[model samples]
Target: MKATTARGTIEAGDVGEGRPVVLLHALALSGRLFDPIAAEWAPRRRVITPDARGHGGSDWDGRPFTGEDMADDVAALIETLVGGPADVIGMSMGGSTAVLLAQRRPDLVARLVLADATADYGPDRVQTWAERAEKAVNVPREKQVDFQIDRWFSPSFVEANADEVRRVCDIFVVTDSAAHAAACHALGTVAAVGELGTISAPTLVMVGDEDYATPPAMAEQLAAGIPDSRLEVLTATRHLSLIQRPDVWPEIEKHLDA
Candidate 1:
């Protein structure tokens, strides 16, 4: 289904019949990234997955946007669809957005799950992101697939799950360079650590032991900063812990049910 928000039209998948749970995707990916999670949760909970503004079926005007803007988009989504606070699970970039959502619109979030995400990228992130944005705009997406794959998955995972890896790669290659650059810039500008204490909802900060993109230290920071939060590090996983380690769902399920 589609909902008109303050930012733009947001395309989402709403299924099941119970308390709502919103699943947000990582950068260069869409709500479709949560298909497995949606399918699993739909039997017991309402699963709502919306494509972040610039990726997948969602609309983006090629203008620059911040993580807070993305969070507001989610805020509008919950108000229009769920009609109340819902459990929110965000991965990577989406994780950062979830933190902003909890900080800026606490009423819209009940339980929070941040997977492979960080509150801040540090002082050098600006130049780092600028360089990455330049690459996204200048380099062909196909050329960058290997680098992304290596960063997203562990060596064992890539060796064992070729088809799944390919599926994610296809999504990455099709993403518009401009949109990817915009998201990179937005991620670089994130600085939400100081606001973590403001989040009142129970929170779970999960990360991969092998995740270099948003490492375990970052998860520790999230857990330490948030008033009611804990950290869990999945063993032998990379940036995409949910995909790389499906067993982690029980932990997520435990948290949600708590």
Candidate 2:
């Protein structure tokens, strides 16, 4: 259903009834990306997934943004619908937002699952991200997504799971370039490393060993920075391991369900 929040009309779903557990989608994806996962958890937790502004059915609400701004959007939704604290799981860009949610609005989160996100982006990384984003916003779409896709999946993943890669590739291609660009710009500005040690919630950080976009080393840095957190490396998978690997969710269920 659509509900007005601090940013705009926030598109969200609540499929179960219990302590709230919000799932945050990655940069190019909408909450729809979590439909399967949400269904799996619906028997117990209140699985709420919102299409981050400018994504899915939600409004673009326009322009330059940051991870903190995205977290604030989530905070507004929580206050309006959830009534109290909720457990949050964020993947990719969403994972970065989860960290901001913990830092900016601590009481809104009871616990957090940051899957494949990082708390640091040095100057070089920031510049590269900014350049890519700028191209998305202005440049033609000739070969924009090529480099990105290469960075996202390993050669073996593409070779072994050609079918799965094609499906995901279709989804990625359909995403709007402007929205993708804005999120890319936003990610470059977010620095959660300074506040990582202050996260008071139980946190779980996971990554795919073959994930090149945000590799296991970056995920390790996230785990190392957080005072109380664990780093898990799912073997034989790429950036989208949670979706690509068949047996990954059972282990994920342990941490998310607990």
Off by over 4 Å in 2: 138-148, 154-167
Q: Number of clashing residue pairs in every model?
A: 0, 0
lDDT of 1 by residue, 1-258 (tens): 888876679999888989899999998888888888888888988999999888888888878988888999999999888778999999999999999999999998999999999999988988998899999989999999999998999999999999889988988999888899999999998999998999999999999999999999999999999999988888999999998888888789889988
Give candidate 1 misplaced runs (Cα > 4 Å): none
lDDT of 1 at 161: 91
Candidate 1: the clashing residue pairs are none
How do the residues 1-258 of candidate 2 rate in per-residue lDDT, one tens digit apiece? Answer: 897876688888779888788989877777877777778878877889998878777787577888888999999999988878988888888898999999888899888888878776665767877887888767655365666556657677778877766666665666788888888888888888888888888888989887877789889988998887888898866666566665766766677567
Top lDDT: which candidate number?
1
**Each prediction's whole-model lDDT (CA):** 0.91, 0.80
Q: What is the lDDT of candidate 2?
A: 0.80
